[model samples]
Target chain A: MSRSQQLYEAMILDHNKKPRNFSVMDPHTHSSHGKNPLCGDDFYVYISCNDTEIEAISFIGQGCAISKSSGSMMTEMLKGLPIQEALELKESFLEMVSTDISPEKKKSLGKLKVFEGVKDFPARVKCAALVWRALEDALGAKSGETSTE
Target chain B: MLNPNIRKQFPVLKHIENGHELVYLDNTATTHKPLRVIERMTKFYTHQNATVHRGVYGLSQSATDYCEEARKKVQTFIKAKHEEEIIFVKGTTEAINLVAESFGRFHLKKGQEILITEMEHHANIVPWQQLCIKHGCTLQVAPIKDNGELNLEAWKAGINKNTGLVAFTHVSNALGTTNPVQEMCDFAKAAGVAVLIDGAQAMSHIEVDVQALNCDFYAFSAHKMHGPTGIGVLYGKHELLKIMPPYQTGGDMIDVVTFEKTTFAVPPARFEPGTPAIAEIIGLGETIDFLTEIGLNNIFHHEHTLLNYANIKLKEIKGLRIIGEAKEKNAIVSFVLDDIHPHDAGTILDTEGIAVRVGHHCAQPLMKRLEVPATIRASFSMYNTLEEVDKLVAGIKKIQGIML
Candidate 1:
């Protein structure tokens, strides 16, 4: 019973209903479309950055609560952060949510630790990781397969 | 309500997963096997494991008999004219690809059009699309009404002179809309156009008579009808199959091998190349027996009852809306709750040991027509209980309370 928690938590649903920075990013430096063709979960991640810091980060798309909330919380987390640290954090977040990690390792996630619950839900890990995968694409860290500009 | 006696036959129905009774509502996708079907398959592998039509030994003869008997069962089940009309393929997809290539190459020309409905599963749509691309033929879609019913007038008009062939599903897997196959077949027949029906979703839920429908080709999967995977039937008219070239070549389908070229076997055998799924074919025979014993009419009535009960209950939920409310539908129900995505609802329901399919269900065009990205589908089967529908209603409420 403890393995599964309220996945559509109040926070996730609120974020879904009123997502932050959920609009087309004008004059963006990088953008990528995150799509789960299987379930029809689609989102776009946009980033504007200087040499060291991300000046702006936003997203726009339709998906389940996990996907939309991931985008909403993600834009809030990475905005105005150092580019290198943000990329590293994105990597850690993806790994933590997709696979099992110790509770001690889970603590490193801070507020995003609730998302680690997705590890218990194998099918939903993709929903939580979709925006980050797009972020990884926008960061120029990975080659985007279905990227839109 | 399902007969308890019938429910007990399916061992998986009594299964306790995550400490909750399993509520299976994704029967359209595939059904759980009964004890009889499972045992029949086991018996084939344990004793009658041998090649067909080329055996000197006694064991091989018995194996051949079972496989041949399975083919006869299929022929009788669909009411096809002869055993030669039933060609075994991997599944419905392969069955359709055979006709798209074999029949398309022989009959279709550059300007000819292949008519299909918008509600068809990808299996029925893609093969024809490939055939059209290869043959430079046009692939046309007959539109479905907002309520998921096919527009009869449009369908009638679509059978113009240029239309060489028509194909559609017996039932919409995504919407649960049972298309009037006999009436549609009549239109195609009137135009002297060839016709094919994808029966993957309909075989378990309804009684299919290919002769009555008079379709040139009918495709269905064994797994959908409590049989094993990797085996299905393509029911083609004897005259058409006899003239049509083999879809695949080599091995069992060959008459003789020579350096220059090889001759192909007659109908059924001509299309079935290489070693077939023997155990699966035999299991399909047992599945026919199982269905025959329970009767298709009984199964159809039971599922329709469940569908009605579910429809009334699901409509009571304020935000929930059933996607397809076709005047004539059975077994399956697709719905969306508030603004909640189907996947989120699926996850919540899975925790309650309820199995419901949530996706575009391989019918994206229908989703576009319905104006929904995806839907939560609860398809019923004979073994499903009334209480299970109540659990589903409760699960929908829980999703509303949590997410809305």
Candidate 2:
């Protein structure tokens, strides 16, 4: 497959076109806005946590296909995971896009591996990590806009 | 008619990218340097590398001569009255900041206004904003029409007794709207207001006569005009430059520094603080020679024709909405494809070796005005061909087919 094909993977395309849980979560326990200053991709992530587990996750924003799909996939992946596990996953995903991860750690990422092509394209790494950065901020003590510079 | 031979002068055009010939349409961002510019810079470093304005050595004198000669070229290029009025800075941003710091601090007072247009780049907007916040001055913005044209009537109305300065772009980087600079400057002058024109996007595509426009100050970059980066010019009137204090204090800007008292230099030396980008300035002089030899009129006509061709060709593609359809637009064409984000479109275009700019274009206020999150911009130069425009259209079609 070509570099573009690898970038716009079938699963990524499907998620972008018909995003799951792609809406605002009202009365959410945690929420934060994310912005990719380089490309002007703005997004807001919402999560409802119950006993440290994310009972619900949703996002509402406007961005490129990679960002929207990553947000959609993030919401789907973090729905039932505990807040700690979700934060760990966010760390793993950031590492995967920024640097090389071990095979065992990569396998643990599951469907998130579709973003492995992101490391090849330095410009698109921010697109894939927009929502994850928002999640990281929303999960932390601080809650505001997070910029992926 | 753009000379096809012009493409051969740019050595980068000979290379291939992504298994396809390069189609560089980001001229509005920064133009590709010609072999003349590159060779001049290389020659300067190899033969004439010396610190200017302190050394008595022959090489130092030659380097200083080259630097001063570049300033003269710039003064003639922009039709400034004196070479001392041209201050070499980092780029357009630094130029504007210098004006905002030196001129703004001297002129602006509490409750006064610095009027600007809604279509200004962040460079033209933010420095004034900083001045406003610091001095309790008001930063007023004139609105743009829906078609991306500057509302001239509104701009005139915004100029009041308390309006201290009027800053605007000669050509819109994002929308490609050429503002009525002469008329605006005349009106502002009638109001006893100073006008600063941001000529970053205008210098390459059009012939700029600062004296004719009667703007108090003008700022532009060299990289956008097929010159080397890290060099630009800020042309201020001699009378204005003589009064405003130095923007930065350092070795060169001072005439005599004593323990008890310090005296500053005059005009250009007062403005240039540190060791300048000597080689880049020499390169800029060479680029000016290259452009002047071809004639700016010929280059302007060539780019205008290419823009018209690209406008017609890109419009043929379905679901592609061309943004900023100003009546007086030049070479910039910014648009959006239906349901396909600009980043995706840019990626697809890149695969076909077509380079374009995709974002708010450092004019977020204009983006909000246009009601687009971002746009894909393909700006042309004299070296670009209509065939490259066809490739852009074809690339957009391929992106639509694959993504949508």
Candidate 3:
């Protein structure tokens, strides 16, 4: 596939159209804001933790399809995983999107492999990782702002 | 009105993108450089590359002459009285900052005012804002009408005895509103307020006669006019520039050096502190000559036709709402589609090899006033054909089909 087609795939567009886990968790245990100031993309990732496992994960914000779809997919994949596991997932996702991770590691990313196309387009890397960055910050900190600049 | 010959001069126009012909409509951001400009720059670097003004050798003299000749070309193009009135800076942002620091801080006292329009780019607004914060002065913004036209009465009402300077854009970069700069300058002059016209968007699109406008300062960039980037011109009245202190003190700008204190050079040299963009300036001069040969009147006429064609074509698309509809606008058309954010639309447009700009366009306040986060802007140039406008329209329709 061409770079543009890979970046804006059919599944990604569907995810953008009807994003899953896109809401504000009222009694959220952890939440953090992610913003890309240059592109004016802003999102707030919310998570409810039960012990170490994630009871729920969701996001609410405005951005391009790449970011919105990635956010939707991120929340979909991270739920039911331990906070540490989610953090580990974030590291692998960032690595895979930015570099040539081995096929074994790429298989580990699962549905998040859709974002591997971002590696070819440098500018869209921030768009794809904004949600993951927010997820990492939400898992790591009590509450703060995470910016992909 | 579209000149096929003119379009042929720009080599980039011949290329295709994404299995489709490239439809470049983002002229306001920066124009595609003509072969003349590119060739001139290449020739300068290949043959006559040297540091200007300081070299006593023959090569240095030639480079200095090239730079000065470019300045003279600019002076003639803008119809400034003297070549020395033109000072070289990085771009419009640096030009405004230079005035804000040197003239603004030096002249305006505490509790005084610097007035600007709501339609100005961030470049024209921020420098004065910084000045206002540092000097305990006030920054006033004249509001734009709902139609995106500058409210002349409101702008005039903002000016008073306390208003030290009036800084406004000749043509708004966001909305293509061609401001009544001559009238505003006259009113400001009557009020004893100095006027500075930000001509970043105007110089390429229209004939800029600084003498006829009679403004204290005029500033624009070279890249926006098909010249190379990192070079700009700031044309200030000699009388005012002489009295205003040097913006930056450095090696080339010093008249005399002593342990006690160093004296500064006069006017243009005083303002230009260090090494300037010599090759880019020469390229700018060539670009100016190329445009002059085409005639600004002919270019304006061609672009007007393109704007009208694009405006009608874009309006035909359902759910598309144009942002600015000023009666006297240039070739910019900013619009938003229903439910689809500009970024999404821009992405879809790119698939069809159509280029446009989508953002707040560095006019966040104007965006706030317009009640939208951002808009899709398709700005035209002289070389843009009516066929390109059709491509843009078709691209938007495809975006609507996908997103809406």
Q: Candidate 1, overall lDDT? A: 0.88
Considering only chain B, report the TM-score of each candidate against the true chain B.
0.98, 0.99, 0.98
Global lDDT of model 2: 0.92
Tens digits of per-residue lDDT for model 2, B1-404? 86698899999998798999999999999999999899999998997799999668999999999999999999999999999999999999999999999999987778999999999999999999999999899999999999999999999999999999999999999989999888998999988999999999998789999999989999999999999999999999999999999999988999899999889999999999999999999999998999899999999899989989988888888899989889998799999999999999899888889999999999999998889989999999989998998898888888987899
lDDT of each: 0.88, 0.92, 0.89
Q: Interface RMSD (Å), each candidate?
A: 1.7, 1.0, 2.4
Candidate 1: residue pairs that collide: none
Displacement of the residue A67 alpha carbon in candidate 2, Å: 0.8
Residue B170, model 1, lDDT: 92
Q: Against the true structure, what is each candidate's TM-score?
A: 0.97, 0.97, 0.95
Q: Ranking under DockQ, best-scoring first? A: 2, 1, 3
In model 3, pairs of residues that clash are none
* DockQ-based CAPRI category assigned to the predicted complex of candidate 2: medium
lDDT of 2 at B113: 96
Choose 2 or 3, whichever is better by TM-score.
2
